[model samples]
Target: MIIIQLNQRQQKIIEIVKENQPITSENIASMLNVTRATLRSDLAILTMTGILDARPKVGYFYTGVNQINLLGNDIKEKKVEDMMGMPVVVKKDVSLYDVIVEMFLSDVGSIFIIDDQENLCGVVSRKDLLKATIGGLDINKMPIGMIMTRTPNVVTVKREDSIVLAARKIIEHEIDSIPVVDMDDEHNVTKVIGRISKTNITKLFLEIAGE
Candidate 1:
């Protein structure tokens, strides 16, 4: 059982809402001597945590004490596809210099490497590029494939997988992002459809927390 500790403000908000059942955000704001906008974030967090439930044209009501447990289960059940973003990809034969430019232009920490058939082949991260450049390799002549972490080594997740599994892979591999791949009949990677990064996971959590 996981216990989510509430902040002082959140605790206070819960107290106020419990004391005044079905209270409006505006009224709660007045009681706290703060504007409704100011309390919006706190309200969101409370609602997301299940500590407070909002009704249309009504007000907020206390749900129950086990809200955090329910929220935790909800997060665990969320699919990776729901949170994946479009991948930043590069051709295997593209020059390292071009790869660098694309990476910077896309503002991504890593890039997926693909073959002419668009099959997932490899992945290149910022560290991989930095190491290659620092080794005095001719960036203009070296193809990105030469420096990429190739297939059979690349960690990948599928669309149907859970976001929790994606997060675990990210942490265990110590990588900034993982490619979300589509599979062929033989279970080989067929295409790079999307990517899951630490930022994506963080944003998902914040979005759920009503941030």
Candidate 2:
């Protein structure tokens, strides 16, 4: 399910795509010496799972890179509010322990901390919490606000920005995630979103490649 380890045939399909060759079930079956029906099942399973994109005439191709670029060009036709995550927030007054627990339970490495007015006040990372606790600070008593990275320094993406831009930010910043902020305001994070994780990039590639 994680899509990290892939089978040999799946890896071969990806290699073909990487070569920019015409990819199809028939072609794949002939190349791999498999049945056309079997190849169809593989493609169907991949495309239906969001790992592959079936173009009108182009058949199957890698979705991670191409899909992201397509999303970039298509973004000009839509708004950021259409794709951003909903408002899921953590309060500044919450304890670091609680924040860590939330991070694990939510399966996110980074979390956004907001003020009472719902404004993005600070950003917290697992490292921040770990450092505080290892320094002999009481996680339960210390407010997350004391350890969070303050505003004007946190990396953020606007809701209206292209998803490609969001993915690029994650790579360029070497960060696990970013906050989706509203540009109309003073860059207040309306949603906490993530991109470029192994789940999105590698797994997607494997599945699309029919792994």
Candidate 3:
């Protein structure tokens, strides 16, 4: 393996390249108020370090480094269910205090609230609990179902949808997560099986970005 050691200047060059990737060395030099030759030398050092790839006519760009496991590049073909976390759920009758305890134990940002029929009823987030607590509402006395968002106008995706497509829903909706619902033979939502969160997309992106 060729290890390219970067000096302070070379590191700065890499940062510049990252900011204006596929940008010419001349443009970088102009931005940094340095000679093109100096920038070129820095770029060369970074390229040697495996942090960048220089094309003949194109320019310098950062390569995806520190890739995740073998699944990184394959996410486009992967489904959300494959990467989803185990279903962590709460019932409407459960006390808010119980839900809080579960949230802490699971170390998750939100909890899936289900109804008596085991269908998705609502969602409760850390913020929701905090808002209630701050307002002097008793956690132990409050039922999660009473405070939870009812039927939340949930956004969901089919189990067969690709991770890339699922990611777009997150970005476009500006939502933190989407419930993964199972459709019955008649094409109606039967129940929520999993959740896809921003954190999930971030992990996938970091994986594919190799860092």
For this target, which candidate reaches the highest lDDT against the unseen true structure?
Answer: 1
RMSD of each: 9.9, 10.1, 8.6
**Stretch of 10 with least lDDT, candidate 1:** 64-73
| TM-score of candidate 3 against the unseen true structure | 0.59
Estimate every model's Cα lDDT from 0 to 1.
0.90, 0.67, 0.77
**lDDT (Cα, tens digit) per residue for candidate 2, span 158-209:** 7667655666777887776677775435554354542223244445446547
For candidate 1, give the lDDT of residue 109.
Answer: 96
Query: Residues 1-211, candidate 1, lDDT per residue (tens digit)?
Result: 2546778877888898899989999989899899999898899988976779999889999887675356456778889898899999989999999999999999999999999988989999999999999999999999999999999899999999999899999999999999998888585547999999999999987877679
TM-score of each: 0.67, 0.54, 0.59
TM-score winner between 1 and 2, please give it: 1
lDDT (C-alpha) at residue 198 in model 3? 82
Superior candidate under lDDT, 1 versus 3: 1
Worst window of 10 by summed lDDT in candidate 2: 66-75
